[model samples]
Target: MFVLWDADGNEIRDEYPPVDPLDILRNPENAAFNLDTIIGRLKELGGSDIVALHQLAQNHYIVLDASTKDGRHYIVRIARNSVTSSTSARISNIRSYVRIALDFFRINAPDGIGSISSFKSTANARSGEPILGPYILPSGLHTPSNVFESIEEYFRWLISVKKTSTTVGTTKPDLDEAQVTLKKLENLISESVSGYRYDAELLRGVPSHQDFSGHNVFINGEGLITSVIDWEFHMVKPAVLAADYPAWIRYNGTADPRFVDKTSQFSSYWMAGPLDAKRLRQEYDAVVKKEDPEYHRALKAGTFCRMAEEWLLSDVVDIGCRRMKAWLENSLE
Candidate 1:
């Protein structure tokens, strides 16, 4: 079973036979919409009164709770975070951030660039300050900075974060294929251009929480978002870049039929938005071609192979790790 805990050491929630939502639902208890129980628990947790738990667009869900004094139902969301143990989980996480950054660049910055809001960027962790980025939760909490303010600060910060180890056009083999692809696509990025740039400034305007997968977002019965809670893995990218952030799951083994089946079970609203699909692809192509005109030209003649080479490495890694794990298990047996 998978369990979630609050800072107080109390169990916040638990799932038996822990699996993704799409994995097991036949068990009535798991399928049961024990709203009453959940609501009761929330009230005990300083929540008002419980109204309803409804599904929202995408895989997100909402919880409606009313304050006893005013009887106004407050919204709360419950989202799932999908990260099973795997060798490249860290790489996958980083790639997910990149995917979100690109996605946000496409949507929110259609005309140019869009940045997510920023917060104090630090927390009270004894290990030092925890990086607390900005995000809007269903709880209706507000950040001190507005979007404009956040975006400006992000631009200023980007000036210092330019990935200097390699130039935009140069290949970065130490990085993943996606990063390499991004590096090759730098010419398309410009200070005044309307797409992702290869410099540090290009990434400045990201809105907080780039990984807005349907699994992490929850909507309630009334269609109100209750909580957009998981900020631990948030990224700072353009707000629009996250428009198609959910698609990143496809790269992380989500394309497997098993994974798809599991996701569909929980989120019927999961589907690509047409406009976004078109724009994202267009933006991707524009960058790839602009950054490596020679490679793009070769691709036109059907000789381009680096792009495919870049994509295949991850699968090779995944297979190698899986085989190693299986072999180890068999040896132990």
Candidate 2:
């Protein structure tokens, strides 16, 4: 579903449309190169507007018009200090993230999140729905599970690429340790778990949004989570990561130093900080436990270490990397 918020932070919820973006781009005249054209096109097909576009990512937001069915428009994101070369890649990357995210939410995340829309064949080739997910509503699709692995893969990819541009990682760092840490973590994931099947049940069961950060998430005055926006970073991944997301956000009182550095420079550009990671974790855990107690413990077992290892080796220093080292070193004591 789409979520619309006004200047006063008041929200309006509506069904999401299932139109192909490429179709509009293909025939600009049909879209009339304007907002109303897009809205009319959305309604022509069986779609609804969820939210008016708002500012998000580095400098972008979705736009909405009251004349439309759900009063929603396109998701507009802007970037800073971007070049023509990088802009294409960045936009392309965001689109890729969206596909993976849709899969993630559909296959792994819990219900009541965002809907996964289909891409137009005329649109970019990368835009394809791997799965429609467990349920497809007239307005949108639902995430069957909460956590998933596309997130892990995304983090792994980010950590592996120390620098996306020439400007990344100019500061002094122990490169040797980073490499070694990554190796260890990879080994652990490959050998430690019986199989990655444990995440099968926890993931959204199709695909989902990977950018489930604090800022993308919204809560009403009563403190209930109302919405999560920004589909640019969405992707297809394992569902377990979505399930454990609330915990990671809530108990972030003491995050790994490496994660701090990474976010400070890159990811946190659009992150919302006021989220209560601890309380959110508690709530997430309670909900999962109520659903299935064993499922909760499974998230803690190998998955936690694997995630930590991935993070440790990821950008350099992670809570998991540090904690794993301590545990191993202290085991002899």
Candidate 2 per-residue C-alpha lDDT over 1-333 given as tens digits, one digit per residue, 9 for 90 to 100: 243332222333323333222333333343212445444444553366533322222212333323334554454222121111232333333333333333333343223223344543536676554333322222222223332234344344434543221222233354444355556655555444435555545533334444455445554333334456776545443445443443124223224332344333223333213343344445545655565564455445535543543343233333323433443334225
Off by over 4 Å in 1: 1-206, 239-333
lDDT of 1: 0.33
lDDT of 1 by residue, 127-227 (tens): 43223324332232222232323333433323222232122213444334334333332321222233322233333343345335545544343323334
* All candidates: TM-score: 0.27, 0.41
| lDDT of every predicted structure (CA atoms) | 0.33, 0.38
In terms of TM-score, the best-performing candidate is: 2
User: What value does the lDDT take at residue 233 in candidate 2?
Assistant: 41
Candidate 2 wrongly placed segments (more than 4 Å):
1-174, 195-206, 247-249, 252-259, 262-280, 292-298, 309-333
